[model samples]
Target: MKQGIHPENYRLVVFKDMSNGDAFLCRSTVNSKETIKWEDGNEYPLIKLEISNTSHPFFTGKNVLVDTAGRIDKFKRKYAKK
Candidate 1:
């Protein structure tokens, strides 16, 4: 609702979910050095994401654990009752 406070450089950008390899095109002002050819055969700026609506547990209604570098195991070992 403010004037001159919004970005005027909105451009089509492809957001790719690394977890599910899902990608979608949307307008964004974020900068990226990578580009991807979309389904429409048009090149767009590519933005790699670790998780998105497609692969997110909250959005997909699936309780999944994504453990990296043995974090879950380390937590269990540290907090486990002796």
Candidate 2:
């Protein structure tokens, strides 16, 4: 490990899973303008996430669709010519 390579501004931040509205507090150096009052009566930086371990298909053992880039339609169109 090299010195000065890690950020010293690691503070408790609230990460919310936007898909499921689940929020958890953890140390993070990431910056966010949004703030939310946590359960501990403290306001923390809110980071909205599309998926988390709780809502992910791999962790929850369920099929989930995440189409941020329309890859499925592109693939189908490309293969439909055959």
Candidate 3:
């Protein structure tokens, strides 16, 4: 591990899986404007995640399509001209 390269602002942050609405607390330095009241009665930075292990197809053994941002549309438009 490299010294002085690691962030010192590591703190407990709540990550909510948007697909399953699952929330979990973990150490992170990510910034979030949202705050959530945890079961411990404390507020923590809320980070919304589109997918996590709880809802991921690889982990849950289910096929799912997560189209974030209009990536598919952009891909088609860019290649359609060719």
lDDT of 1: 0.91
All candidates in order of TM-score, best leading: 1, 2, 3
| Residue-pair clash count for candidate 2 | 0
| Candidate lDDT values, in order | 0.91, 0.91, 0.92
Score residue 41 of candidate 2 by CA lDDT. 99
TM-score, per-candidate, Cα-based: 0.82, 0.77, 0.76
Q: Of 1 and 3, which scores higher on TM-score? A: 1
Give the clashing pairs for model 3.
Answer: none
lDDT of 2: 0.91
Task: Give residue 64's error in model 3 in angstroms.
Answer: 3.5
In terms of lDDT, the poorest run of 10 residues in model 2 is: 62-71
